[model samples]
Target: MGPAERSVLVAWSTFTTTFTATRAVTHWIRDGHGPASGGITVGGRHFHHYNIGIALLSAVGAVALRGQERHRRHPVTAMAYGAANALIVDELMLLLDLKDVYWAKDGRTSVDAAVGLIGVGGIYLAAAPFWHRAARELASTAVHRPA
Candidate 1:
């Protein structure tokens, strides 16, 4: 309802979309169904998705901390943060394994992580108001009720 809550919803949606799209595209390419080009390569080294995610996150943080007031709450920043988070989360297994296993069975870990994040985010958003109300009531009872 409030701006903060709305922003969170938007960010979550963005994250979900980015995560799903990235996974789908990667899987398609891995299955030899997409373009011949595997991915971006620079200077004989392949750039991972997480690398771009990190850069986007850094840019978002820098802009949020140093840019003008109008830039702080911009939707672009929120979307960037979401996409960055997705990219990083999608590579959880790769990071842990320290190798390219994205197309292997182990790669399912990324899907699990992404699904878990979505579930948790949804639960948190849905229950936050109830939690806040309960906390408020508890505080009021502590202050007003006899000891």
Candidate 2:
């Protein structure tokens, strides 16, 4: 209903959509169905989406932290943050292991991580009000109690 809630909903939706789209596009490219059949090669090196994700994440973080409240709460900002988060999460395994294990059996970890994130994100969005109330109550009780 409010700006914060709307932003959260937008972010979650964007994250899920971007994650699905990224996976499909990447798979298509990997299967030699896209223009960049062997992946985007520059200077004889393969370019990975995670790299773009990192950059996008950095930019979003910067804007969120340093920009005005309106900028921070903008739908575009939320979308960017969500999309970047999805991209990074999608390749979490590669970042963790610092290896090109994508498409390998080990790459399954990336999908696992993405799914876990989606689950957790959904839970948070669904229960955030309850959690906020619980936190406030706990804090109030703690402050009033005789320690």
Candidate 3:
């Protein structure tokens, strides 16, 4: 995998871990309990842009990796990967109703987090091959692909 893919995976993993850990610890602060199945509420707010930061961070990582002496121009894949992540998260938000955050004793997190999860998962799936050399591989693929 390339640096871009690796960066995204690292970021996504970190992001999810951070969010999950925050939720577990701050469940009491957010509301009565942790994330729920059907959907969870966030400060009673309708919209939460969790992946915006993701996109920005991934974009930066991709750009930097491309400029580095060794790698080729696979930054676009990173961009595509990052874009996929953001797009998936946004789409998941709407589909899963991510506003609602709560978890039952059964370890059931809300469906609200589902979309974002899918998005995150998608990023990994895309980066599975070259997460370490993701930037280069993506660049290589970009050049080899017909269109």
- Reference-based lDDT, each prediction: 0.87, 0.88, 0.50
Provide the TM-score for each candidate, comma-separated.
0.88, 0.84, 0.33
Q: After superposition, how far is residue 121 of candidate 3 from its true place, in Å?
A: 1.3
Deviation of model 1 at 27, angstroms? 1.5
Query: What C-alpha lDDT does candidate 3 achieve relative to the native structure?
Result: 0.50
Model 1 alpha-carbon miss at residue 145, Å: 1.7
Q: For every candidate structure, what is the RMSD over all alpha carbons to the true structure, in angstroms?
A: 1.8, 2.7, 10.1
Question: Which candidate order results from sorting by lDDT in descending order?
Answer: 2, 1, 3
Which model is ahead, 2 or 3, in terms of TM-score?
2
Q: Is candidate 1 or candidate 3 better by lDDT?
A: 1
- Write down the TM-score for model 1: 0.88
Residues 15-115, candidate 2: write the lDDT tens digits. 89999998998888878896788778879999888888788889889987899989998999889888988888888888889998888999899998888
* Candidate 3 per-residue lDDT over residues 19-101, each given as its tens digit: 45444444554454535532335687443334454566566667566656443334444444444444344334343553432
Cα deviation of 1, candidate 3, in Å: 2.9
Superposed on all Cα atoms, model 3 deviates from the true structure by an RMSD in Å of 10.1
Worst 10 residues of 3 by lDDT: 100-109
Pick the lDDT winner: 2
